[model samples]
Target: MSKQQPVLFSIGWNACINCGACVAICPQEAGFVSPFDTIAVDRPCDIACLLCESICPVDTITHVPVEQPAVSVVTVDR
Candidate 1:
């Protein structure tokens, strides 16, 4: 069975200088730069393209694995 990996992106608000590099480079327009100078990821990403991650000048655009729900195993007590 093949498992597809899903990624969750985060922008380091403190480190982000509002350069708009990521926002401009993302073809999907997934990266947004608010008028208040905040950066955010507005939607789920397929991660097929990493343009935003590659174009972040401050290296603030990053992704971490989304945690999978825990599976419970049933065991019989003898």
Candidate 2:
């Protein structure tokens, strides 16, 4: 049976510095720096390799675990 991969999301262009570190380290070639000066996630990647987060010089890249739920909740009692 084929293994399932995790869904990938794109980091905003403003936060990306166009550093090629993500591209170099990704074994899946999931990360790429576009011509428009933005970092893009090419496809769903479940590599679990944190190279992109570590190699980002500007600290722009962030890899959040998919299983973790958001802590924020809205509660209204009236």
Candidate 3:
């Protein structure tokens, strides 16, 4: 069976620096830098694919497992 895609959310989104790293690293072409210079994701993406999540330098974006309720799982670099 196909794995479910993850839903991405920006936590404390005001902290985003509008760096295009998310867009640049997204192999699924799911994320983009908005005209207002903010990070945005419009397309669906696979949860198993961590390309964007791992590449985000600021750790502003997060994803919830498809099986779980949509919640913000904050990713931080320790």
Candidate 4:
């Protein structure tokens, strides 16, 4: 049987300081920074490793587990 791939997550550019730590530590090479001033993670691989989250000097990056989604709320006034 084939192993299932992990879901990928993206890092916010506003929070990222363009550090290459994520790119270097990723075993999958899933992390990369584009010349256009953006950070990206390859789908089915990103998995929010949090390595970048810890190494970031500015504390701009955050890692959310890919398999989980945040719940949102909407309220209606009676």
Candidate 5:
């Protein structure tokens, strides 16, 4: 399964009222900020459960597909 990453839209950034709902619901602890600042902290994530997205009251959180590493194949000729 593909892992998801949460993104806070610019519109949501401006609309955010410093509510801790998203930060509290995040299972990965990917988002964090001070009470006065709404800016979220970025971190490496393995699971994107979308808990934060579901908890956002203003619908500011969205999930984007994380790019997976490409696999290389080598063919041998006899």
Candidate 6:
């Protein structure tokens, strides 16, 4: 069986309202404030937790569902 990759933390910068909710709620301390951008993920989320996704009131943060590859089998006809 093909394995489906787990979803990870993500954010939509365009939709971000500059709210500090994400920065305040993340336990991993992955989020931070930026001078140019309102907030940024300073580093990759090593734990891959969904805390950032749930805390965003504006729904700017989200997770991308992994796409599973198709399986094929070969058959011989006699």
Which candidate should be chosen as best, given lDDT against the real structure? 1
Task: Tell me which residue pairs clash in candidate 4.
Answer: none
For residue 20, what is the lDDT in candidate 2? 70
**TM-scores across all candidates?**
0.56, 0.50, 0.52, 0.44, 0.52, 0.50
Pairs with backbone N, CA or C atoms under 3 Å apart (clashes), candidate 2: none
Off by over 4 Å in 2: 1-9, 29-42, 64-78
Error of 2 at 1 (Å): 14
Error of model 4, residue 33, in angstroms: 6.3
Residues forming the 10-long window of minimal summed lDDT in candidate 4: 68-77
* Candidate 4 lDDT for residue 48: 45
Best candidate, TM-score? 1
* C-alpha RMSD of each candidate structure in angstroms: 8.5, 10.2, 9.2, 10.4, 7.7, 9.9
Q: List the global CA lDDT of all models.
A: 0.57, 0.52, 0.53, 0.48, 0.50, 0.54
| Per-residue lDDT of model 6, residues 1-78, tens digit only | 113343444567788887777767655433344553434444334334566677788888776553321224323337
How high a TM-score does candidate 1 get? 0.56
Candidate 1 per-residue C-alpha lDDT over 1-78 given as tens digits, one digit per residue, 9 for 90 to 100: 114343557788888887777657655444344553434454444432566777777787777664441224333338
lDDT of 4 by residue, 5-76 (tens): 234446676767776666566554433544533345443343344565576567665433444222243233
In angstroms, the error of model 1 at 7 is 2.2
lDDT of 4: 0.48
59 Cα displacement, candidate 6 (Å): 0.7
Which has the better lDDT: candidate 2, or candidate 6? Answer: 6
Compared with the true structure, what per-residue lDDT tens digits does model 3 show for residues 1-78?
124555554534676776767667655433344554444444334444666567777777766554432335534337
Model 3, 22: alpha-carbon shift in Å? 0.4
Off by over 4 Å in 3: 1-5, 30-43, 67-78
> Which of 2 and 5 is ahead in lDDT?
2
- TM-score: which is higher, 1 or 6? 1
Model 5 global lDDT (CA atoms, 0 to 1): 0.50
